[model samples]
Target: MTEQEELVICVPGQRLCVADKSNVAGAGTYEQQGYIYSKLAGIVKLVTDDKTRTVEVHSITEQSIVPAPGDIVTAMVTVVNQRFCKCSIKCVGDIVLTRPYRGILRKEDVRAIDKDKLEMYKCYRPGDIILARVMPMTEIHSYQLSTAENELGVVIAHSDEEIRQMMHGFGDSSEPLFESAKIIEDVVLQQMKIIVRRACEIADRRANSKKSNIINGEDLLFLLRKDKIRLQRIVKYLELKELGCSVQKLMTANDVPQNVTDPEQLDIKKKVPFQSFLEQIDNTGELLENSSSVDDVKRRRCIRADIASKSMDEVHYMKFSKARRVSFANKNRHKFSDWICADGDVTVSKQAYTILSYLAYETVAQIVDLAFLVRQDQGKMHGDAIDRQRLNYINPFTFKPRYHSKNFVMKPLTPSEITEALRRYWSPQLDMTGPFNRWSMRRPHLKLLSC
Candidate 1:
């Protein structure tokens, strides 16, 4: 093999050459499907012999090393107890390990001077980086660790208060500390994963119960309903997203005037500028033009009309009555009218009165139309002679009874029966001939007996 061929680098699973009797697979190389592939990421080497050529890959990276007895190691305390503390070994001597190894530090080995009095919590807390010596392995899983020497102790320690201070920006200003950020991020990600996994499992179960292979939104909604807080958060997020998207679309499509100089001046309760209002009208026109369907255009128009009607109603109320204006101004307070003198009489202009009357008429008309529809439905049900007793028991609005009892059957009274019952209960002749009336009457009947 030439020097140029020796310089060829190959990654894991990369094909090197065709495998044959003349070319045999060597270390770090495997032969499959008549091809020799590299199992390590390194430079490809070809060794030539008398009969065959050997293909191999020499790795460029260092091999993983583990802590041995008597080796000095640096580790972070993970769990602390009164008897012992558990740590994760990060480095051996000067070299950092690719992955951490488990180590146990007993309280007796915390310090040589006060071995008996040493407490694991005082010597090493969780998140503290410490130096220790690896002892002979007592267990196959974790290595025994000792910090008996003066030098072998906590190198860096951060208390809970210090972490809180750092999070709240009260710590050192020169450098930003984010030691706990990664841990927090990992915990949050794990929680999210658990929630999503559970939701997916529920959805899968629901789909299976319904004899379906596809899970729909209803299944997910059922899962979300079980966690109301999370569902509320999701709903709030969706609403904000929708609002942001609408704002973004408006900003992108039109050159809206920036009247307010500061963000603080942009209040929802503040009156809109004339220019902004006109610009909104123009933007709405543009939106209508860009709408994909007639339904979209009609929906937008209806929303606009609703907003206009609400504003107009507010204007009419404020103009027609000073009491309403005061109430509107002091909306946050209960009994706002008590703080100010109410008008003895409201003097409504003809135009305001006309608008209010029309609004009332429209509202009543809508109510009447709804009632007529309900009555028609009831008539059709009655005409069909299907469940007539149940129909009488049902309410018009909800189409369900106010109360239901299995023990008692309800029978609705007819108008004539109700009138007859009232007449019998309050007959004029019965009331006039009562003992109370006889006691209050004049004694003219007694005079006839004397005559």
Candidate 2:
């Protein structure tokens, strides 16, 4: 992704000039949109005329790979000026990013927070590592990049390359950020699968529609959210509604369930207790929808480690027989060994705790139990844990919940229980204006609720 790493891709619709490392031009440099590929890695720079169609590539490496949509590029913040911070892309593949192509990161695209009072020093120093998404390629070969994304900022801080690798995705994830980062990969892969799967599923869903009520755009968006891969399945379905209810019914050859809440009540608002909250005229839903969808936020949670971590004093769970687990976790973790980093494997990031304590330490059974409780809450269960009517999900691995218990077998959370965490190396108060997607949606809801 770096400029020196090799010019892999050109602008989406436009191709730029390229050359090889030996100062030889693989493809001659050409001019387009008032800017020409002035400099190319490896080969000598070729100054072409305005009328030229193809670009002269210098020192072409591997036929000059080009940048396209959805390429993960890593870069370092070289300049942190007042209005913007500049950096050169690095690493396209295992080749080790070389050529330093300049990319500008406007102050707005830095993070998700207020901009005027943001301190660049706290968010990003001159040498801070940044992993950003390529939002757009602007004029003059400038890449319009964004760091406001979760898991898009620095990952593996500290100078140790090996530790960086572990933080990135190498060793057993022992830190919250590291583990979240690991999960991010899983989620991304899942998203890719979803995108592909949905296509075919929609087709089949459409084919089976008894009423021939075709799915619409809105339904496509919803399908994209639930499981992107499902949309690409055998059902070449289409929908006008984002909920995709129409498409689901068509594909399955069944009646699309109405938005009614209760089986018999018919009115969802009456059945749901949060009716008043949903009925508010604060216009929060629109804001949230425009910024970030609820589903998008959850997906990003798995993808990016830049989540909030409600931290407290490191209180140990003494009741549980975790002495051996704690000792083992501390001894093997790399962050624990580094005096600059781990203090007995306890890192500063809240995400570190989530990684070490829950995801890493707790067995999969415990995780399943936790996931069940969370989902139950999402399912709108009410009352104390002891009085819950029913459990939402059964652990596939466990095969059963605690017998004779109204709720799943679980203990009350102590104050030290870390609810959420964000694994990152940047200061708070990033560019708040950038697209939060699902997380962003909550802001409007939060604002309305706060009032």
Candidate 3:
């Protein structure tokens, strides 16, 4: 063996050194066939305890925390009655229980001060998960559970699943669960912790309910989010459990938040509408017309355009015609360019119109509500006329487009009229130094007629 290999760390089942008359196996190591093998995957150390040297492997994995008497555990109520309630221990302290231990919370042991006045059915119901203290073993079948303390009681219930789901549905991220499951797990876990904490706060506000003095779900979530190593190990343990594999794991420190000593602060922002855009537009389009320079006008127009885009919805009207194109040699067949030409009267090409006409002719149902279609001819055209349709009205409840009674779009202003208006109202504001400064002499806003 090389000199570096002799001192390197090792994993489980790796042979370290010979365990003979002088050498012996220590903790985290096992000896067989005159050779010592590491029992744990960790760093190997040679310790001279009382002058007797032995090799040992110390694992880096955190040790598992087990439930014991006097420890606080979070349990879910499975069966509840007037006499007692049965629960499955979900966690011991801050560590989640991989294997849930059964526990029984007797009615008499629910509260210390109000034992006589309190009713088990009134206080806790089935499916209500609680935080309780473990009592000394009194029953052979289950661990004795106590919630007599102020902080120990039902923190969550089955009825609250909808609220939990609502929180999980936030950010519209539920669809990506299959794509990135770990991310969903982390997000859901964080959301669940927040919901549980809120519920606890609400419960603590009750007149009869005592102030919670125990660690909450938020604390557990904080530990899981901040400790990547621990989270990975936990996930590994869960994965092993599913695969029926054996795993030896530990929790290094008691994973609890340092700020758990104080109650969490709550902040809620009120939803309000942005009415500044509407307020600016109320001046009869003065903001656009009164601009001192082209830059100012451009800036205002861009701002207005952005606001308009946000309020307006884009609608794609699908062409449903299905007329097949006839051969070019046929005199009855229209030319290819004619089929795709655009006009103020017909937005779609003759080819697209043929299909829409076919669909309209064949189907009894209206194709307007169906899938939206785009014309290949218009695809290359920047700022196509069809894309600039401004709706006359939008249904407030449904946000659906509403057309004018006559089903006609508003006509554009004549180029001469536009030029005259600009010269009278806008030309004086400009510096007018360049040859293109004259608005009347520039490109006319004339509509192009299709061939």
Backbone clashes under 3 angstroms, per model: 0, 104, 11
Q: Please list the residue runs of candidate 3 whose C-alpha ends up more than 4 Å from where it truly belongs after superposition.
A: 1-65, 157-451
The candidate scoring highest on TM-score is 1
> Lowest lDDT 10-mer window, candidate 1?
442-451
lDDT by residue for model 2 (128-170), tens: 6678776657656767678787778875453322222323221
Tens digits of per-residue lDDT, candidate 3, 84-124, equal: 98999988778775577789999888988867787776777
Q: Largest lDDT belongs to which candidate?
A: 1
Each model's C-alpha lDDT? 0.48, 0.38, 0.43
lDDT of 1 by residue, 321-369 (tens): 3321121112312221221122333222322222222222222222222
At residue 47, give the lDDT of candidate 1: 83
